[model samples]
Target: MSESMITKQAIASGFKQLMKEKTFDKITILDITKTCGLNRQTFYYHFQDKYELLNWIFYNEVILVLTKDLSLDTWPDNLFHMLTVMKENDTFYRNAINHSFQEEFRNYLLTISEELFCSIIDHIKVNYSMPEEDQKFLSRFLSYGVVDSIVYWVKEGMVRSPLELKKHIVSIVNECKMYATKHPTTLL
Candidate 1:
């Protein structure tokens, strides 16, 4: 990685460590810099604020990893990987979900989920015609439901294993696909 990327990763690492010990609202930039052996200017140079740092962490560590060679056939595995990553970093993610930056976190998930659903919908459209506007609407609709389910899962202490959650989501999607296949002319 480049020096700039290395510096940002260091900052992200420090912030994640702090998140494990303290609530997101309570951890200051000074705390992160001190933990990471960097200065405030370095953190500021890479991120606007702690919230932005949190977004960066999600984008780089979670979304970027999930989007690699993503396809309808692989989305379940990708989502499972994301949940596994979140479970591995439970403390940081739990803190993020419970904190003031919850909207940002939700928006990030929504963006990724929408993209994933759009791809699935496009694949389906190859077999069944769907208006562009309807495709966009359906993708957004599914994205919201999936994102909210994830947020609820996180808030409920993540009782289900990542595999279990992935299976549940996959079942739901499969049901939808079955319905679409059975009633091809009605979905539009």
Candidate 2:
């Protein structure tokens, strides 16, 4: 839309192409610049390093995936849309997902998971009476579980399709809630 947005998109698109062929550490600014047909200055003007660019992309996608108006009713569609976006950029994700700097991707997942868990806590508050401390604790605890499951799944080569995995995650969250109800003593 705007000049800055176009530049950002160019950088992201360039990075995705470069990543398909090499590791993140191996990627240089020139490589990205050359791919995008932009000079070094433009690249630096938008991002300090590859990591920063990666983070920008992750944050933009997370916001696009999880809208501010989301509720429990729309969370599934939002989640699915997020996965669809990821799959649409599968080359980018597969590269990052399987790259040497996978910790970056993990960090991205964790950050988004935190936001997702906060939404869950909000939904819980709407339906039940819970203390602020309890809400944060539950959200963080469940978010960690979801984050770990996603990391494990990604490492396992994503054996299931995006849609199937979404269903699996939803089921896992539901089961965790059931378990928590049955074993209230486990809450810490």
Candidate 3:
């Protein structure tokens, strides 16, 4: 990797390490720069703030794990894999989850989830010519429901096994599919 990439990775890695011990509020830009052996300007050159890093890590890295091979045929399995990934990064998520500004992170997560859901719905629409109104409704419900389920599971410490969570996700997806089957319409 180039020196700039190396430095950026260093910053990201350093921030990940710090997240284990300190909440975002407690971590200063200087601390991240010091830990990465980069100057403050170098850090600023890459990221505007710690929250921006958090957004990048969550959306770019984490979401890819959630959506990889994301065929509708195995969405529940993909979700299970995503939960496992989240468990591995539980410390970072927990820190964000416990922060006073947690709502910000939660909102960001929900927004990303909504976008992913819309993308999937768009795929379904293309396949079936679903009406715009029904498509919007299904996308809104599925997106909010799935994101809420994840948030609730995390809040409950993920007591259910992955298999069980998969069952729940499948049930929800099936219901939405059934609704669409019953209400299919042409997009004008």
Candidate 4:
């Protein structure tokens, strides 16, 4: 990695460590810089604020990992991996969701989910002949459901294993695919 990336990763690591011990609202740039052995100037050079650092962490750790080499065939596996990572970093994520940046986190998930679901819908439409409007509508609808489900899962302490959650989500997705294939005309 480049020096810039290394510096950013160090900052992210410090921020994540602080997140484990304190709520998002309570942690400041000084705390993060101190934890990571960096100065406030370095942290500010890479990120504007703690919230921006939190976003960088989510994008790099979760979004980048989940989206790498992703396709319809690998979507389930990618999602499962994403959930597993979140579970592994349970304290940081739970703390993030419960305190500050909840809406921003949810919005980030919603945006990615919508993009993924839109692509799925586009792929399905090659054989299903759904209207463009319907495809967009269905993708947004599914995205909201999936995002909310994930938020609920995290809020509920992620009691279920990632595999269990993945299985349930895949089952629902498969059912939706089956429905779209079987009743393409009625999917409005």
Q: By lDDT, who's the top model here?
A: 4
Candidate 2 residue-wise lDDT at 2:
96
TM-score of candidate 4 to 2 decimals: 0.94
The number of the candidate with the highest TM-score is 4
TM-score of candidate 3 against the unseen true structure = 0.75
Number of backbone collisions per candidate: 0, 0, 0, 0
Residue 142 of model 2 has an lDDT of: 71
lDDT of 2 by residue, 89-155 (tens): 6667666667654676666666666777667656545544566676678777777776677566666
Per-candidate local distance difference test? 0.85, 0.74, 0.72, 0.86
Which should have the higher TM-score, number 1 or number 2? Answer: 1
Query: Comparing 2 and 4 by TM-score, which wins?
Result: 4
TM-score preference between candidates 3 and 4, better one: 4
Q: Estimate the overall C-alpha local distance difference test score of candidate 4.
A: 0.86
How does model 3 fare in lDDT?
0.72
Off by over 4 Å in 2: 118-134, 178-188
Candidate 3 C-alpha lDDT tens digits along 1-188? 79877777789889878988898899999989988888999988888998887776776555776667766555667777877777777777667666733566467556666666666677656547766676666677777787777777766677776668768877877776665656566321
- After superposition, the stretches of candidate 3 with alpha carbons farther than 4 Å from their true spots are 100-130, 161-163, 179-188
lDDT (10s digit) by residue, model 1, range 1-188: 89999999999999999998999999999999999999999889999999899888988878877787888878889889999998898888888888856788788878888888888877766777877787777778788888888888888888899999989988987787677667766766
Model 1, residue 101: C-alpha shift (Å): 2.3
State the lDDT at 85 in candidate 4: 94
